[model samples]
Target: MRLALAALVLLLAGPTPSQFAPAQAPAQLRRGLASAEAAIRAAACDAERRFGEGDPDANASRCEGVRGPPGVEVGRTSARLRNPRNAPPGWAKAYLAQTDGKKASEVEPAVFDLGDRVGLLRPIEIRKRCLSCHADRAEVAESTRAWLEAAYPRDQSFGYALGDLRGFWWAEAAK
Candidate 1:
C-alpha cells in the first residue's frame, strides 16, 4: 500500500529533469533545422510556381506537403501572422525579440533546452519567389489574394520585400 501511494505521488508530481535525455548537440540540432528549412522553402517555392501556372488549388497544397525529419516537429512563425495557429510560443517569442535589427543571415539558429525536449529556431528570409503570396497587397496576383482572403481572413503576413526577415522556422525534438 505504501509503495502504491508513493508511486501515485510521484506520478502526480510530473516528469523530472532526470527523466529526460540530454539535449542534442548544437551541431546536430542546427543540421536538422537546416534540412527542415530547406524542405519548407522548396515547398513554398513549388506552391508559388504552381499558383503562377493558374492552378487555383496550388496556393498552399505544396507547402502543406512538407515534412520534417523523424522525431522532430517543425513549424513557422511570424510577428505578422497569416494563420493565428502559427503564433510563436513563449520561448520562440523570447528568441525572436533578440533578433530585432538583424538580417536573417546575420542571425544564428537559437537552441533552447526545454526540460523534456530541445528547440531550435532559425530566421527565414523573404526571397523573390516568396513575393507571390507575401509581398505588398497590390503586388500579389488577384487570384492569390482572393484565395488568401478566403483561407485566412485575418492574414497579416504581407508587405515583405526581398531579403527581409519573413519569420522563423522552428524545430523541436526529444532531448
Candidate 2:
C-alpha cells in the first residue's frame, strides 16, 4: 500500500526542472539579446524620427540625469542582464578592452563567461544614431555633453571601427 501511494505521489508530482532541461544557452541568450537589441534599435529609430520631425521633446532628457549614458536604453538593459550579481552565477563581462587606441568598438562584442555552467553570449552592434548618443567624450552634444564629460572623463568609448563589438547581452538560464 505504501509503495503504491509513493508511486501515486511521484506520478502526480510531474517532471522537475532537472528532468527536462534546456539545450544550449545560446538560443535563450540570443532571444534575450535580440529583445534588448530590438528595444535599443527601436529607441534609436524613434529618436531619429522624432528629431527629424522637429519634435523638440525628442532632445528632452531621456539620456540625461546622473547614472550614465541612458540614450541606449536597450543597450543598458543588455548590460544589466549580463552583470555578475544580478545575473546567474554563470555570468559574463562583455566589452571591447581597448585594442590599440581604438577603444571598445575596435574589437566588436567580446564576452567573458565567468562560469562554464549555464549561459551563452550574444553581441549587438551599435548603429549610427546609437553612436551619436554613445560616442566618446567629444562627440556628444552640448546639452548632455557636460554630464558625459563629468561622468566618463576618460571616456574611450567613441570613434568605433566597423564590425566592432558594440556590446553584448548575456542570456543565462537553467542548464
Winning model by TM-score: 1
**Clashing residue pairs in candidate 1 (N, C-alpha, C atoms within 3 angstroms):** none
Regions of candidate 1 where Cα sits further than 4 Å from its true position: 1-69, 100-102
- Candidate 1 achieves a global lDDT of 0.68
Candidate 2 pairs with clashing backbones: 108-164, 108-165, 109-165
Residue-by-residue lDDT tens digits, candidate 2, 1-175: 9999978866765432211112322443444334334454455555455544356566446533323122222332233222323332213321222232333343333222223223333344555555554665366687766765576565445555445455544333222
The count of residue-pair clashes in candidate 2 stands at 3
Q: What is the TM-score (0 to 1) of candidate 1?
A: 0.61
Question: Going through the candidates in order, what is the number of backbone clashes in each?
Answer: 0, 3
Q: In model 1, how large is the Cα lDDT of residue 60? A: 59
TM-score of each: 0.61, 0.37
Local error of candidate 2 at 36, Å? Answer: 12
All candidates' lDDT scores? 0.68, 0.41
Tell me how far candidate 1 lies from the true structure as C-alpha RMSD in angstroms: 10.7
